[model samples]
Target: ALHLEMTGFLVVKPEGYVEEAAAGEEGTVYAEADYKTQVATNVQTQEVIDSVVVYITGRNYQDFPEVVALVEDATDQLTFAEDAKAKAEAAAGTGDWQNATLWAGQWWQYQVKAADIGLRAKTFLDEHGAVETAQ
Candidate 1:
């Protein structure tokens, strides 16, 4: 039996600068920040989905010397699903589900695992100077 659901994912790129009008200044100074947004959805239903955005801005950007390092760290921590998939495939090699439930659980575990990973990654990023400006 196949349990089907609509699914999709998105990655948002950050805008480089923000514009503001100073009280007495003639022009705007560079805000100096980066941002990204991500979203996921069920393809069949087309319903609104929960999502997260990671951003680095303001004085925080100045404090963090390696912004990309933070991003890479976050990405590195999110391989749980990939690992789960590999384990599932290996277990299915014997053509059995009884002993494979642990590995086969990957399908159900994906979303939860991914979400947890995202949250943790976001936390790590924030601690290192990445800000969550919006969802």
Candidate 2:
């Protein structure tokens, strides 16, 4: 006979938006939510653990091309943020307070893009992914 037991779980919810401007026009066009899960197992004990994460994102676009560009830019920004965070951590460890603080500020500034990131992601998922607003 075999038995399975539940152990532990966690969840994360994130929300954000993207805005675009072109020719003095600006708008928000898309929004989205993402869900993720993680699991762990103990073979002998037959115990399982699971975790979930959810993120919400949105964006505004002046045109379809702008939306596409925004998506690409947002992806690049995310990569930059990751690198900046790592550099900041390294600076802190090295006792370079000034550089550490600057990097840390950069890391935090990158966090502001969460909304823009979400918006671009959502726009990419949509079939007619662009929305325009009168300015």
Candidate 3:
């Protein structure tokens, strides 16, 4: 079965960045980090298939409130089902398997969200679900 795991908002700093931020070290710079908000997996096989994530760059180490707001804003922007569908379809149409898989995973997320609200949703994987094959 398709398993959707809601990871929610997670802010991951670079290696040692957390300690540096805690120590209030000077000359600290900011870079972007991808936060996984949600993930999809095959329950029977325990294989990760897709995920919803967001990236944000920041400068201030103590500005968690602002960062929280930014995360919320970015997460809100990803809830468009139509946009996800369009992107997924467009990618698939162009035979961009990589992007197609990414967007399709995103589209599946919207579908799962829809299902949670009592709306009908479709599955993204085939009848066998997601299977890992050696490349």
Q: How high is the CA lDDT of each candidate model?
A: 0.41, 0.44, 0.39
Model 1 reaches what TM-score against the true structure?
Answer: 0.31
- Residue 102 of model 2 has an lDDT of 61
Model 2, span 35-133: residue lDDT tens: 000001111111210110011122244345655565566556656767776786686677665555566556545544633554544546465643433
Clashing pairs in 3: none
For every model shown, what is its TM-score relative to the native structure? 0.31, 0.38, 0.30
User: After aligning candidate 2 to the native by TM-score, how far in Å is the CA of 48 from where it should be?
Assistant: 27
Q: lDDT tens string, model 3, 1-135?
A: 113223545555567774533564555222111111121221211122122220122122123454345345434544665586577568657766556556656666655553332211112212223233332
Query: Which parts of model 2 have CA positions greater than 4 angstroms off?
Result: 1-66, 120-135
Instruction: Give, for candidate 1, the lowest lDDT window spanning 10 residues.
Output: 30-39
- Sort all candidates by lDDT, best to worst: 2, 1, 3
Give residue 98's error in model 3 in angstroms: 0.7
